[model samples]
Target: MDTLSALISHAEPKANLFFSGNLCGSSSSTDHPAGGILHLVRTGEMLLFEEYGLTHRITEPTLIIYPKGKAHRLQPQTLDGCDVVCANLTFKDSPLYRALPDAIVLPLNELDNLSDTINMLFIEAFTSRFAQVAIISTLLDLLLLLVLRHLVENRICQEGVLSALSDHKLSKAIEIIHKQIDYPWSIDELANKVGMSRARFAALFNQTIGQPPLSYVTEARLLLAKKLLLKGEPIKSVSLEVGYSGSVAFSRAFQRQFGITPRAWYLKQH
Candidate 1:
């Protein structure tokens, strides 16, 4: 699988449509902890207020992405208000969430590839059609994917996993890591696969991804183990599935990373 595909295959984002209409007044994100918040402005103008006293006056059609759990607000610039379709986006345990900026503002016209999808979404959101809600929900999910693609292709992220995926050589290594996470991968082998010397590849990966390759592998394995364990898989099976030699080693690593034992973590969740 390709880098972006592998990345998404491991963690696909979900969107829950919460509001769709003209905003004559203001709206604040009271939902304290969401993976992200998305807004597509179909018409008119509005002012975006973000944390740290940042503000942006948005005109024309635009896409706003708040990719972290940061507070934000929106108010109309005119009495006519702005027509918008908004959703709460959730990317549970996704590395992309940490790589994304506090907020992203992109003019709709700039995203030519999304024009058709955006139009269809606006029509469905405003019309009273059969399964309108369902259709809109699906469209929002698609939009989120497209936005991620845009970010990667455009090199919107300067650092972190997303940025690393944008690099041709690093992306190859990342794809292999995600696709065969259960394999016993070594740094030298990863570098050879990507045609880079061990030192160069290690340095580049660390520079771009902000972590050593092996450290990233451990993180990915543990995250997958966490998911499997949550599904009621036995600890032994989960450990082996994520490339651990035994449950004891996996438990030690899990506790070191999460500050609790695997059983204790799962029990707390239950």
Candidate 2:
């Protein structure tokens, strides 16, 4: 697993279809919750407005992703019409979620490699046959994955965890940490895994990821522990699951990381 794959695995993103239909001689505003939003245009044209100003003239088979869930307005350019499918993505908290931009627009030309997937989405949206919901749901999920791949391949994102994953050597180390959160890891061990000296690896990892290797590992472990705790796992089990030798040590670290005992945190969640 590379950094992108690890983050995606941890986030466990789910895409839910929100709306699919034609728009003509009308305008609509969509306010999305705190997640990602995707809009795929199958026909005609529309104008997207951000901050009450025209942002992009969405024509052709285009896909737009608002990774931060920024609210925007969309209106058909003419009475001739526009056909679109929109979906909302809910993701568990992860650095990849924060790495995405406010919005990304990929037109037909840019989505040439995904022509088949795009065509299928349009077909499913219009057919309205049996199991259409299930089919569309799967296609939307596929589309989101493709979008993430495209973003990384095109180097469109320049900051946050995604940017760090762009580095080949650093990505390898990140993958190891994510896959083996229960392992007793140290800066020297991580450095050796990536074939770098401790000092050099520390410098490069810090420079690229904005944190030291050990610090990143600690954060990753705590994140996994929190997720397990939220799932109603026992405190002792969660502690060992995240590499702590005992609950007392884990509790102290957890308090330092989150300012509350694991049991208290779990109670609040309930």
Candidate 3:
């Protein structure tokens, strides 16, 4: 499977439309939200006020993304205000979310690759159409993917899984691991697969991914197992699917990682 597909499997993203219209006033801090906030400015001008007195005067069509919910304000600069589309971005708790920077602000022209998609989103937002909400939501999802692709290709993320995925050799190792999560993988084996010395691979993986290689494997397995268990799969089945030998071993590791037994966690969810 492609690296992005595999990565998305672990960090599936969802976007929900919250606002779309001409804005005449400033927005309050959005620190209370659960996920990230995305704003697409279609016209006019505005001022972005983020924490720590960080400010930007936005004069053109722009895309503003907050990967984590943060306290920020958006104020209109022009008397007529700006035409904007906004969405709430939610991602599964995974490396993708953890590795992202606090915020990304760029002109819409900078993402010319997404011009068609952006145009469609703007048109749909302002015009009456059938299934407009669903269409806009789907387009926002696509926009998220394209933005992530831009980050990866430009090596914008300085560290963590996205950074690792940007590295030619490390990405290969990650791809294989995601493809075969149930396989018992050793560090030496992964290093060899990626044609790197085991020692060098271990160090580089830690440097790029911010953790030991095997630790990541265990975390990946447990995270996947957690999702499976939540889907009502039996613990034993989830265990084996995530590479554990038995439910006992899986439960023990799960407890170690999560501070609770699988049964308890499952019960709490329900």
lDDT of 1 by residue, 105-136 (tens): 99998999999999999999998999998899
* Candidates, ranked, lDDT: 3, 1, 2
lDDT of 2 by residue, 134-177 (tens): 99999988888887887887778876567767788788888898
Taking the tens digit of each residue's C-alpha lDDT, what string does model 3 give over 1-270? 787678887878877889999999988555335678999999998889877764789999999988777778899987898999988888776667778888898898888898999999999999989999889999999999999988888888898889988788999988899899999999999999999999999999999899999998888888888778877999999999999999999999999999999999999989
The residue pairs in collision within model 3 are: none
lDDT score, candidate 2, position 67: 71
The CA lDDT at 244 in model 2 is 93
Q: How many steric overlaps does candidate 1 have?
A: 0
lDDT of 1: 0.87
lDDT of all the models against the reference? 0.87, 0.81, 0.88
Candidate 1: worst 10 consecutive residues by lDDT? 27-36
Instruction: State in Å the error of residue 169, model 1.
Output: 1.1
